[model samples]
Target: MTRTYRTLDVPVRGGDLRVGVWEDGTPGAPTVVAVHGVTASHLAWQLVAEALPGVRIVAPDLRGRGRSNELSGPAGMAAHADDLAAVFAHLDIPAGLVVGHSMGAFVSLAFAHRHPGLLARLLLVDGGLPLATPPGLSGDELVAAILGPTAERLSMRFPDVAAYLALWRAHPAFAADWTPELEEYLAYDLVPDGGGSLRPATSYRTTLEDTVDLNTGTAVTDALAALGHPTRFLTVPRGLQNEAPGLYSPEHAARLVATYPAVRHERWDDLNHYTVVMSEPGARGVAAVIREELSALG
Candidate 1:
């Protein structure tokens, strides 16, 4: 399919926020608004978008990330969700499927809660459920584990985009699954910081705040329980490489299914949190689940 890109500026809480949209398939076809995870931009949906023919796919760079970094806001889930709502209103897209991955899952949940009538279905790709942090783990410690690489990268001034892309390609998380699509997705996350240096578009402060929000799971879990729309939760079997077991386990996912009887839960055994949405195979699996769910909804 031939894909087209466009920029959208929608009014939000404090000011206007920019959204990068990838439009493909048919104009009047059912739309799927994809929300990417923390530290990721709209490009994260590239593989999924390519697989879903006959559907209008819209993936937006959330506030403080990608082209929307300049967008003023609180840099929390509610703020991101509100930004999505604004986009829907501006485009006059009513009642379409909502798909979210990781932090994007939280944003999707929040949107479903705030604007119940606006979503036809909600599909969470290995995220959106409550995650349990070790009780003794301090917020700072958690942030360090999660944002350490980003901090290190943002501190160094990359000589050029190629240099930055080289570093990303060598990263362990993506070492085995690197592809041209993944390269383009990573590129979207980079921006010229200053002095002819490139840096990630997401700010350290926003990254930390997003971490705290995910660790707490306050808004997301509550929103899931309250959401009236049909919802699907996809869980990754392998936890973070450095973390203890049960951090994001199948048991936890089962409990979530029990709590929200309306939620359809599934687990992908071979993928980790990052790979679940980053690789072609993982993205294809997620797309299949989404297709099934949306078909059932129809």
Candidate 2:
């Protein structure tokens, strides 16, 4: 089924935040606010919204990414969480389900921490729990270590969307999972830079700041400790580059679930970090989880 898509600029602290809303024109439909990864736009949730035909999905381009790239402010888990609060207010979403991917998972946890009353529950995808990082790494080193070429691409300029698409087309993570939806998502990520070139809309500085904070800051840790909502954490077997042992190894994921006790854990052995929501199969799996969670709410 085809869903209607619309964009709205929401008033936020530094500037207007661009929000994407998708729905099937159902009256009084259940609403979910989805959050993308650190360097992603609202378009990242496109497939998931498509899979969820009658549900309304509201996703935002977080500050310093997508159309919200120019918003001035320090980017961190806490700041992103507060921005989410504003999103909930702007839409009058008193209590809503949330789904966060990658760094967005961390932001969702912070949102649950700061604005618990606004959230019904959480669906944290491939993130939310603290990552195991090497000891005593600087911010840049940490970003470089975790994000690798993904972070480095923020500094590079593309001649056009095709060039940018070409980069991901060759990525191991998307090689077998490539789809036109991925192309559309990647194209929306580009904005014009000076000198007739285009760069990714996500700010490298913001990405670095967020990466450091999620890995080192107290916000996520605090949120995990005080987690009061029903949260489900899904893990992928492959990492960002389609490498083995993705974000969390089985033992590590089990350990996190054991530690948190409140968060339910599941693993998708065939999917990787990026494909967990970007591909059709992945989106369908996520949508199934969302449907189950929504049913549970009723």
- TM-score of every prediction relative to native: 0.90, 0.98
lDDT of 2 by residue, 1-298 (tens): 4689999999988998999999888877899999999889999999999999889999999999999999987889888998999988999875969999999999999999999999899999999898878889999999888888899899899998889988988899998998888899999999999779999998888998999899998999999989899999999999899998988988889888889988899998799999999998899999999999999888
Candidate lDDT (C-alpha), each: 0.77, 0.91
Worst 10 residues of 2 by lDDT: 87-96
The local distance difference test score of model 1 is: 0.77
Q: Flag clash pairs in model 2.
A: none
Give the total clashing residue pairs for model 2.
0
Instruction: State which candidate has the highest TM-score.
Output: 2
Residue pairs in candidate 1 whose N, alpha carbon or C atoms collide under 3 angstroms: none
Residue 145, candidate 2: C-alpha displacement in angstroms: 1.5
| Model 2 local distance difference test score | 0.91
